[model samples]
Target: MNAESPNIGAPQRPVIRQLSEDAANRIAAGEVVERPASAVKELVENALDAGAQRVDVTYADGGKTLIRVADDGCGMTAADLPLALSRHATSKIDGSDLLNIHSFGFRGEALPSLGAVGRLVISSRAEGFEGAQIAVTGGAIAAVRPAALNRGTVVELRDLFHATPARLKFLRTDRAEAQAIADVMRRLAMAAPYVSFTLRDVSGGEAREIFRTDAEQGELFGALAGRLARVLGRDFADNALPIDAEREGLHLTGFAALPTYSRGAAIEQFLFVNTRPVRDKLLIGALRAAYMDVLSRDRHPAAVLYLACAPELVDVNVHPAKAEVRFRDPALARGLIVSALRHALAGAGHRASTTVAGETLGAMRPEGPRVYQMDRPSGGAIRSAYAWQAPIFAEAPAPFAAAPEPAPEAVNYPLGAARAQLHENWIVAQTADGMVIVDQHAAHERLVYERLKRQMAESGVAAQALLIPEIVELSPADAAR
Candidate 1:
């Protein structure tokens, strides 16, 4: 061996041993408790599963210092409190089967995993039983004791990620975390319209309610529409198209925004499967394809869509966070969404309100024709016009037989009556509500495209290349392929 070269030994043998329950829970917390928002999601899900019609969430320091979720739900008994803080002790499911899961937080990992990383207190009073409470701090279990409560359950978490200080470093600023918490609340609120939700921001000893909504009951769609209007705003409701479609036991319902009322980003799009909000690629792609034709490439349509199907048809356990799912028939899911929404959007034109929005979108283009600029009268009430391509706009054939202008009644087409032709390529017309300016060449292009489509459908399009034939070598090393 060289003088400076030290002796090398074999790698140490790996040890295979089981992890302690506390250690396992802490590991699970790494997956479950990603941030303060994750803790909020897990806690809220538990409350919803408890059959709470009203849920109130309050947090301070973006949930790092304190997070409390109180719900008027069916509370637990004294014996259940300690088990509720233990790992894998759940009342939501029986070990008899896993396929029958309908409840939201069924993994039985949320409470224990949360307890593993933070200080947790759960207090509940089931009907006909005395209220009880249990406290757990960093996987250390506390005795279950009698506690007073009106009804339902109350869970409070403090000093989140205290046991795992590294997680605190991963958390964003208070404002950002607060915004994320608000987003989580919004999604949950949209999912369960029948349930009331109140979210509060209690920072610096000041209590500020950030969001509040009362429970909506009665007809599903009626209540949902009212809730939607409240959450999404009246403008979105005004432009939204309602969709209720079903096929092969897969039901889809909710509202879709018109192409005319599109957005630059997809933040406004909300999707739910069986009342669980998810942002899946399959669902998003289906929606994108649904609006592919009516909406421009750069714009995204806003919507709050819901999907309902049998439990067996979808798997919600694919992710630890349960924010995504795997469908039994992805193609069917995609088809149902795309076809139903497209059909609804196509018919929504009739239900649309008579507004200047359509005219405004059409008038954004440059005023001049491609080749020439007609002298425009300035500072006058510019009449709305529609672009028309009918041959009547053409000049008279005979120099001495110039055609007199058509009667104003003749300009009653959808685009409005044609007014004048500019550069023989553009038409300006007037409509009952607004005016349109048409491009003759663009209209001709569409016409040609439709003609080609029809022809191609009848007899497949034939391909012909214009490249000259040249053969140098059978297998040239410089070949592009």
Candidate 2:
């Protein structure tokens, strides 16, 4: 009868084992370098962090077959080569300090992960040492040997996804991949206008002068505009409005297109943070909302908005690709975008343009004048001989008099030079068909809605609260839905 004698035992737990260095590196590489473009991004970031003034990216067959990034920055010494490939190894930050990251790339797994998945060769030379070469294939390291090279690093990757053919199958076409690579390069070029970039396609023998900036000038906006004009097209420069605003310790600066100058696609909306290009849904949503009143729903605005703030306020490690980010105060970020863009558009006197086409038929007569008659009082007395010429008829002549005045031939007035804009919102005009009524506000609403839906489908929506409370009294069922 002893209820306290029940058996008690500790539950067994499964033991976890750390993966081997090679396996770990490969796993990390899977996250960092999902495709050849990702590898290119990581290597370029390293070169930029090394203070490289010029970066050259060459690739073949959409970078699946080969990719090489060469930079004219301070190259790694012979001793640093091995350390650079090791996991969790980086010269940028010391241990116990993960909050403040000044370099574009501080994670040291990029090179090794790439090496694990494919063939990787790194050649470099420091200021006062002979050039050195290090090679790795399928996570196997080769001996470092002396080689002839310049005063920088050249990282080459070949036969990507050869060890993992499954990953290769997910890749897009060669042209599409090449375009993605170019897009990545263009964004980076926009972020760092002081750096020079060159991209070449070895397979098609095509080359592009992606970016070139004058170091002495040191004008980020001008250089960005020039580069954007070169890469995106010249029309963007003509239609874009400059953005400069600050709020809640965050500074927003860049160019946004006028409502009249929107695009059918959002491929031109480039966003950057602390000189690094990113694609965050909240930011994109805020951008769409800012232009909602001006742009049509099916269209997207051309913009390049740079957001600068303390690193602690934003977390860039939310995604392995570093494309998306989480902000400590997302509302502040959204407000910055909406207010900055709204101010810029208003200052630019943004307006929608419209056109109409039609062919004239023939002349037509104007309608006869409308007439009204009143009932006469009961007859009082007979008066003069001109009784028929009463007061009403005294000021007008008979319609059938004088043989109908030769039946005056019909005439036309050519709809008289379409009326000008009424109150800046409505446009009044006359046509042979009928009068036309246009609601500027409603038209713009439709436009913005379509655009927002499209953007949400492509990149997701960014929601922000109104600065002022937006109160509404709705029925219970409707509110719940």
Candidate 3:
């Protein structure tokens, strides 16, 4: 150590201490409950894990003031209340096996984290046990007391981030936060088609329903289709094609809209891994790759895809919020996504979306009824018209010259035989059942490009030499120059 160093008088030893329970929970809240939407997501997932058939969510002032989630699921008893608020304690999985996680939440930090930053109240009633309620404020827990409740569990959070006032400044406007909450609800609803969901805004003491969907019945695909129609709109359900494909041990199933029904943005894309919604880069990239040849760069494909495999094959603990995941064989998953979507698209042939027909009809509709007036011509006008028809009607126009007719075989061929050329660029051909119009230049260019690509792919565009060389005659002086 140099004597001139300012650290010469500083203590040589450093001390480390454990964080208090309340402080530790508050820190966890910073990760698990970043904002109002985070709280909504955690609570909803818990409800779903409880085997709730229906979930209802209500929020006030973008969840900063209040947020409530109620579900008719198996409620926890009085003894389970305190344990539920303990960090790293969860009923979803055993500590021995972390690889095979089936539930939406397994970290067991959501309840405690919320309690550390806000006033949390949970009221529930089990089937055999009486009703019970527990309250926690700023990481301080109160004793469970008897309360009035029918069945299921109800979690209410009030004054979120009140304990940590500095976090309030990072939140967005009330409307934006509410929109985030709605997005979360939509994703969750799509994942579980059998469950009914409802969302309401309870601001200003007046409750207004923001979204609602009843439980769908029937088989898996049918129920999922009905739920999708209710959530993504009927137009998408009408235009989208059912996708079902399996590779190795992984299976991919869902609906992908036709290329003609693509979106301007990727807002409609939803991906799930074992019923857990995720925004993974590999899956999204593979989806884009599958549609690369059919859609332009500016257009994005719309789809709702679910990839299912053994739970042991994937790791969901990659992120604190469990929004991202890792697969044992990422390449296999990507290939499955790309191949399945491409096959579905190819199976659709050249068919356009049905929604396009509706849009076309709307565009062709008349603005209003049109009126036509008819008047009688006078005798002088009729006489002048007859005078202009003089000269034997111009010798009957030379018997109306006509071109030769095309053969039956030619007409039956695809794209038909060229009947006439218009403006030296368009070909008007007669098909078996209709007339075909082709752009001569554009069609020729595409054909040539495809042929070149095939040739390159087959044998590196095979070199060719001219059999007969052409000679150009020129003056000696010009050739030298």
- Per-model TM against the reference: 0.74, 0.72, 0.76
Off by over 4 Å in 2: 1-15, 204-218, 352-481
Best of the two (1, 3) by TM-score: 3
Instruction: Candidate 2: give the clashing pairs.
Output: 285-462, 296-447, 297-447, 297-450, 297-451, 298-451
Candidate 1, residue 323: CA error in Å? Answer: 1.0
Q: What stretches of model 1 exceed 4 Å from their correct place?
A: 1-8, 350-481
lDDT of 3 at 422: 57
lDDT tens digits, residues 195-304, model 2? 77877778867654333333323476777777666555565666677788989889999888766566689978999988878989999999999989987799898799
Kindly report the root-mean-square deviation of model 3 from the true structure over all alpha carbons.
17.0
- Weakest lDDT window of 10 consecutive positions for candidate 2: 355-364
Cα RMSD (angstroms) for every candidate in the order listed? 16.7, 16.4, 17.0
Mind giving the per-residue lDDT tens digits that candidate 1 earns over 292-383?
98778998988899999998899888888888889999999999999999999777642333133333234432255555346664343242
Candidates 1 and 2 compared: the better one by TM-score is 1
Weakest 10 consecutive residues, lDDT, candidate 1? 472-481
